[model samples]
Target: MTEMRLTPLQYMERVAAHFGTAPHAVFVSTFGCQQNEADSERLCGMAHAMGYADAATEEEADLILINTCAIREHAELKVLSYLGTLKALKEKKPALLVGVCGCMPAQGHRVEQLKKSYPYVSFTLDPASLDKLPEVICTLLEGGRRRFVTGEENPPIAEGLPCARRVRHKAWVSIMYGCNNFCSYCIVPYVRGRERSRASGDILREVETLVADGCHDITLLGQNVNSYRGDCDFAALMEKIACLPGDFRLRFMTSHPKDVSDRLISVMAEHGDKIAPHFHLPLQSGSNDILARMNRRYTRERYLTTVGKLRAAMPHIALSTDIIVGFPGETEEDFNATLQVIEHVEFDMIYSFLYSPRKGTPAATMEAQVDAAARAARMERLLAVQNDIALRLATPYVDRTVRVLADARGKQEGILAGRTDTNRLVYFAAPEEMIGQFAYVKITRAEPFALRGELINPK
Candidate 1:
């Protein structure tokens, strides 16, 4: 595979010539986490800069990109299945270009497999090499058969990159890239590489620009956001972003329990009103034995203590978490311990998954393996228990007055949808003009997953 580089304009010219049009239509399908979503946005921005217009439908798109994820076996399979559909499209229109980019390509074996199986895919580019996308597209346009673009080198942190945002009021700001923590059951560290925080000045400038552009909410994205040590570290970054001039709100996710510090909690408390009162801390296992096996670096007791500290700092904070069920050698006692933690924490939301072994990870080669049927049963039971808790936690908010930033029009008549300060989805009846503004909403209904409210008055 030959590596190629081209300027943005030259890349656009090649694409336009290949498609026989100035504004070529492009469609992107993104999978996995928020980090992937942010990468997709940047990819779209690059395409837009290259004279490619957003396609209304896949059938109409001249170029289609599958921004993939390889966090789990199922996610990878889903991406491949999607690629199968695009195969027929490529056959019909030989000029139609298809590309696969993101974590899947970052892994050597997966890239080889993709090349062998999906010949319709024109190129494979890693997420970290986003700046090289124009060059990769240009190579494909120039009749390059196949190529894989990835390396250990950090690409330039290109600022002022144009983006076609999926939403108007909410924006995702990638403050950093990659992860350093190599948990035993995980593959993120291998795929995303080590933690590399963006400079504070770049992050602050991006946020300020979004604020000026009428973005009222921003989520600082990173693999392990709490580990972000820009100029001053995660705490300092939060303080600086919170103090920025705007009527905007701030939030972040996927905090490693080990990296979260008292100083960060204090910063959250100080800006509790401005910061969305939500935290998505991953607690993979509840048993200390399993925690150690998983290399989480924090025991169940330590995690609870950190939760306690956050609650004490911001009494009204809502908690969400990710839990992996049925890891290698997980006994009945270990599963029960996870259930107990769910009951105790009463998370606002829980992203639960049955552990699927990823081939290069340590857990895959471990001798112990839980039965598939048993894993499915355990996952169902865990979801049932967690859903009940989520409903209970959400019920109290019914009939309470909460502030919501109306982000979009709703499906129902004269309805609008937005998220609460705690990141709760709130649907309310409001006029269209109120779509990008904040308004007080009086909660009238509550569900396990969403809340219903009515607009009270403009702020």
Candidate 2:
């Protein structure tokens, strides 16, 4: 007789039945990017399907899952520190199931360290092994040994997993997974695997459902969104979504300069109103020598040209960028060139980072590694420069009226927080009911990091 094969859903049912009438709770600790947040939603959804209630805090949880990031040393350190804190909780709850997944565990060294040092961690799964979560849970329920699942360098794309979205009006639809660009300074390709795009139909259906369900903001996510190759190209895919019948704003991120095409720019211009007028293009460094060493493949001039085209097409486009303060073989001239580019671009926002070496990446072993003090000094200067640019650019919007989505409750009482189409944070006084809805706001004041606004027509 042939052996039976059960799917993830069946495994979910098995776990749910194992819990029967008793209540179980799961606490999910997610660290890192927007992509990680999306993955957590799915994690929560799966846990629910397995009959685990969402625990408000770790103390109340029967199971704890830590979704980690391995992009930089800082994030990894944070995750490690967090895990140590969980040890006390695990000690108190002897039977608590603890799992760590995502990029960090995908690395062999990290997995071995967890196995040796963190025995309380019942299992570890990489992004590729995410779908096997229920099966792992079932095995644990049977009192099996510890499990460590290292995902393949290049794995197949998994689709149709249930996601318990934390936000009611905002959604992140991962259009593609993994990356092909092996940037010398990047660990993404190593941990997350090679690039693989979802079918165009799958993406369209997901967007359609979100729009039908009152989703007001949808972001298409990818390692390099512009490099998406589905039934349609990235530009064509955006056009299709933009044309969908909905009152929603579309956005994407982390575009590779080398992949930004003329068609993409044209499509964005055509759907400028439907698509948010904000682009997050990362310019790691402005020095050609540094870029060459980093294997970015696009020169400083090319990045500027792309930025020029984006602005030319949409005059009011808000440009944000990622900048690494120091890189291997960087000199004062290279750093100055970066500052010069920042000045030339006058980016609305800059996500600046001090370079952190990852063991497996080429940049880790390169000569002339920037000193910690030098990196810190350069980061300070970079922020000072960008702060001035940001203030100057933000001040002009003080008297402007803009559309904003009331996404969250503000830090203060009687306040609602929202973001404008250009991705500017706006705070206004409004009812809690206003959350998940859109409204017109008249900016009364502008701060360095946000704008103070009032609802135009309070309802």
Candidate 3:
């Protein structure tokens, strides 16, 4: 996996000469999802390989790269605003290189207009061109003005590609790339391109290497992980990874409600020792009418059926979800129906957002567009309801002993934090040495968001 697909000989020589002086400092400001964070890690790893050191701040860095997100309009705006601020920095220091990557550059106009708007900006790369980072930076440093390393789709690299992982024990393994389901409101399929899953052998080999390297918690990442059609199906991939010799806990994210199958649930049930029971099946809207309009391809009943199966397979499983409150043409009944689904599902946590239309999406032009004020109110209402639901669902875990993979240090004195198999954040009093290890913890206090716990003897 470390063997790169592309290597320009001239760029390599230039980077070597550039590195002969001092290591270039790189500051990567990552925005959006886990996938982006994972991409950032690879970006850093590539930078590191090219003799770049980590920069503590944007100002201190020789290169300032914003790993952008375009999921919502606000996210995109934030990146643009930041880029505007960087104009001063780029102007002040002629050598200070500014680059943009991720979904923002993938958007057509953003890149086209960026060339004129911010000539100080050194380069713009799309999400697929992550591996090209080394060359991009080298090219920029070598004083070549050919900006925008895009249009050429980056082929899938092997899984063990070196990454400057943010966490010592937790790692993100992207089993697949892109999306096939073009939900009316989504721009992922357009920006990220069609589904291209990584090879199974590469994934497993990566996992094995990670486990050997003291990383034990692994999250399989994708736009829609469940729809993975690599060398094997998603379920089969899980089974293979779960069987691998390791002390690792496995997790996957952002499953499309339509693609999560019974076999996946059964695999989770079978591999209780490894696979964590946290299902994040997004229910965009509960109303069938809205669901149809959104092109989710699954009704409320079908979604519920899958939920029931998951719960039946593992009742203690934490169910999180992505919810959009006010899509085009949504009504009172539609909003209420979403609330009903929230109540019916009793999700452990919810990542909710007010619907913001993307440029190329079908829903953007639809009639009866929701009022901005209504969308805000609906979002507030949805949060309030889900907050109560979260607390109610969390209440049962109080005083229970659960295995926690110590992952973070709590702000509270003498406490270390980790997550339950169900993905509940549990903070327990433990030494710093236990940060990368598993501990049995007895929950002492519970809230909607986290649990305070005391470490107990495993025996």
Candidate 4:
């Protein structure tokens, strides 16, 4: 007999038959970057189509979907640790369906381990195969067997997937997928496959929809976002989105230094009103030799030059970056160079991480691997230096008035939180109704991590 392929409606019917008229709940535990978060929205959207409602907690979920990350060893370890806790839940509720998805399932070894050790997991689907989720769920329900569904070798872009965004006023739109720059220590390219940019028309339509739906902030996502090339380049695509009439600010991330072209900078400079004056260009290492070893494809001087161009174009642009403390064979001189760049840039924020060797990456097998303790110690020193810089940068925001989009409720009672266009977090006392609207806030005080402000205008 030939295998069957079902439409989304058929899948929903199958799901409905399995659970009957009783309500079913799904809990999605997402791990990793914004891209993963965006992917989870679609996962939940698929669950909704398959007749499942959102579950408040894992214990209450009829189906549990763990969206795994594979960027670092530490993240993978955390996923495994979390999965251990679910085994008991699986035993208690034998009817519960458990699935693992995302980058972790894309790896061959991880799938094998899940099959052998994690028998309770009903299915494992890779990120690119997300559209096939309902199909996998249907298979498990009908065939009564675990399923392993990997994405296509060179996956075609899946457009028009419904997204149930977690935040109503903020949204993530992936303009592109995957990475072309391998960067010896990175595994994104291998798991996510080659780069594929969504057509400009598709992206423009998505952004227009979001803005019309009252989204206040929109972020374009990709592993190497600046490298996007579809009907138009990344720069041209930004221009199109910026031209769209809306009361929203745009942001993008994980730009490779080499891809931050003058044209892109010029476009951003011209459209400062539409684009957020915040840039997140990663400077993995500041030492030329380390950068070469990492295959980052840009020299330290080139990286600095890009930053210079950005600063020259937008004087008040907030700069943030990602830094890895120790890579294979990093010397004290190299580490110092990174510190010097940090001090020189005076970034608004820094996401620093200690090097963790990932299996199958070139750096994992490279000679002169830095000691674990040494990496940890270096990370501590790096944090201290960045904290001081962050504090200094934040201090300037005090007594300054900024327009903020109140996106969340603050930790304290009767407080609302929002971020400035520069992506600085600000907290102020405001009404609950102000959560999704723009507000003028006068900065009262500043902390290294956030600013405390008083609401100047309610709306």
Candidate 5:
């Protein structure tokens, strides 16, 4: 049987008749950042509304969609590998349909290549067009030929969309979409398009909904969260949210140092008790020349000053950072500068990656190259220094009583895991009933990755 494609409106008309009495099942495998996860929720909601049921496994799915990421070379490679596996499955189940969406499909060349190489892939859609998913799926189900819908139309927030959430207590609320900052090595600005903040009313409504659903923590997700300038802007949004009627904690991520204003810092200081005191500021490079080349728009001195200010306001702030090693034209001197910054800052955690060329970016076309061996050596040295610092920073927490919100069960029996306000992972023995509530725990042992603790008072 040939595949058919139908528009969203068309899909709605034929949904009941096409499925007959049987439910159409869909399986979504999401990869990459929290933004992708939030996008997948809407994707699933669209599928459900189109008379499709959620499948337990890919093999059981009548339709499969891979929400992919293209931030690093490895992420792209993994998507390709998954496609190969799906291709083999398609041979066995000829009626099954597969699709690719999200950041990878936003790239024209990648979409073209997928259409050419994987004829089995029924369609490709961009993240911004996800609300039109029912129409896209309808087109495929109606026996239309393989096609791509890389449309530029931004979809409105599918408010009240149904979701099969992967987590129960913690929910990711997307305050905005896309990125305006085009860092030299990044592909986000090109693929995700320019930044557009969601309306403040919409964001507040979402957070209130999550809290009502018993969600205890909300992480506002974005590429440059501090750059959010909806009607309330970032600082005002944080202040308003902190005052919401709930014992829930608020958190956000991936702040750009250049945009971390004093007003925002003051908001954090005022609501330090309600807001998680953890910041993940990406310091791509420590050398001013390297930062300039990467177009990060912030000097090492400026970054250090911001860190100093944050520490002054919140002394026990748990600082996490992102570092990129082996960027194009990075000299040994430049790499050493990063080490010096790491030493001086003493971050609690670091997400380090070797620079990978991304298509359609200025850095990709640059001529300078670091040898593979040298890059590996530099990464190993960087990790060693970071690990040593992480251990030193974690040791001081031992023997202190900290309030923790239990998130999940631990790997061992009778063990439960939770996070402190600063986002430290603490595992302690507690009953299943206490999993979603707050408890005061005494840290008995400390490790670089997690802390061992016990419930000081069980209610």
Candidate 6:
């Protein structure tokens, strides 16, 4: 089947003529991972193409979108609280179009909760129905069009839509969508459906355009990139991107340990710095029992083997991971095992979370749910252990010279910060002209999270 494509102004004209009005302003509040951020960019781009200018604030917006997440109960509750606050605003401005989108609204269970509990919300759209955003927005704006466009037929691969990307320098390109690994803790597979890879030609073209558009870094976003199957596999795609005509960096994330292959590591090793020296291999729980329960499909030993192979391939690779502190039926012994794994791994970064049960997941109904207070304590201990390891790992950067790509300005007084090839955040004093370029910095200070450095003339 052929896809329908439209230029930015073409859609803008269609919306303008349909509504018989001038341009509108839009405001989108996004949550969750980089994939959601990237999806929001496309949403904003679609709005702009339909003659919608981004509002400075939600109060001034003609359309307000709540691009939400449901990974944890906390994430969902945050969105719910925000929606409660917006009810008065929706009352005051009846024409103010408000809708919920992304993973939360797409869940089959959340439909009634949105419709009954938050009736002020005019409509809902899933990530898959984003291509129909103009139609949805126009209908809702016309009044008495409250509905949900979710869990419907959603094709995985979407191309050629204009985007109002949040980060100009670092482009997020989705190589594939959905997750095949039904990790018991995750709702991604249920909401996002199964894995579907985009054509390699489509991905390469997107990268080429972003580079031409002055993007200095390209981050490939996927639930599980290692499972990507197209004209090329994940490793081949990375190699092709590394070979592309550009001086920019290439990075991907959230690789399932079970699917990550030697070929992928070899490709990164061969390409070296071009493909980045950072690998985010999530080790959810160190205990073999917990791993079996979570359906992660990999034992602690297997995960360590992958880490060893990665380090062997590229010794300087800065490692990062996702960890769950208090899983269902987790004992003190299991928690200690997790800490031991963290101590042994010495990851440069850890994205830790206290597991929150999601409705319709197997683990939610599982017996022996850990106490909230216990979870908090476990979380604190896990963080303390990980923080100490991170600090030690970062210490080597001190008195070393590293190349950093300036991505943004630092929070410190007149400081500029960027990231190294190993995904290390380095802050240094530099001119604003270096915002989107590479520069060498002499590391002077090393913290658990970031490195403080001084600018050095590139060698």
On lDDT, the leading prediction is 2
Cα lDDT tens digits for candidate 2, 7-72: 878888989999998999999999999999989998888999999999999999998999999998
lDDT of each: 0.86, 0.90, 0.86, 0.90, 0.85, 0.86
For residues 1-459, what per-residue lDDT tens digits would candidate 6 score against the true structure? Answer: 113545434545567676566667889999888989989998899888777888999888888988999888788999999889888888898788888999898886787899988888888888777666776665555443687986455475657887998776888999888888888888888878888899999999999989988887899989999998989899999999989887788999879999999999999999985898899999989999999999999999999999999998898888999999789999999989888989998999999988889887889988989999999999999888878888888998999999898888899776898999889899999887788888999999999999999999742
TM-score of 3: 0.94
For model 2, the stretches where C-alpha displacement exceeds 4 angstroms are 1-4
In candidate 1 the C-alpha lDDT for residue 103 amounts to 90
- Among residues 3 or more apart in sequence or in different chains, the pairs in candidate 1 whose N, CA or C atoms overlap within 3 Å are none
Tens digits of lDDT, candidate 5, 102-176: 999998888888988988998888877665677666656777677687766455544555566676688888888
- Runs in model 1 lying further than 4 Å from the true structure: 1-21, 409-411
Q: Once superposed on the true structure, which residue ranges of model 6 sit more than 4 Å away at CA? A: 1-12, 19-21, 141-144, 151-156
Model 3 residue 364 CA deviation (Å) reads 1.2
**Backbone N/Cα/C clashes per model:** 0, 0, 0, 0, 10, 0
**Global Cα RMSD, each model:** 2.3, 1.8, 2.8, 1.6, 2.7, 2.8
lDDT of 3: 0.86
Give candidate 4 regions above 4 Å deviation: 7-10, 13-20
lDDT of 4 by residue, 154-268 (tens): 7788777778889889999998888889899998988888898999999999999999999989999988888899988889999999999989999998798988989999999
Candidate 1 lDDT at 396 equals 95
Candidate 5 CA-lDDT value = 0.85
Model 3: per-residue lDDT, tens digit, 168-225? 8989999888888999999888788878899899899888988998997999999899
Tens digits of lDDT, candidate 1, 1-459 = 235555665676666666565567889999998888988998898888777889988889978988999889899999988898888888899888888899999988889988898888888888777767777777767677667778666665666666778877889999888788889888888887887888999899888988998999999998889889788899999999999988899999778999899999999999876788888899988888888888889999999999999999988899999998888889889999999998998889888888889989998988778889989999999989987987888899988999999988888989998888898889998899998899999998888888998788976
Q: What is the lDDT of residue 203 in candidate 5?
A: 87
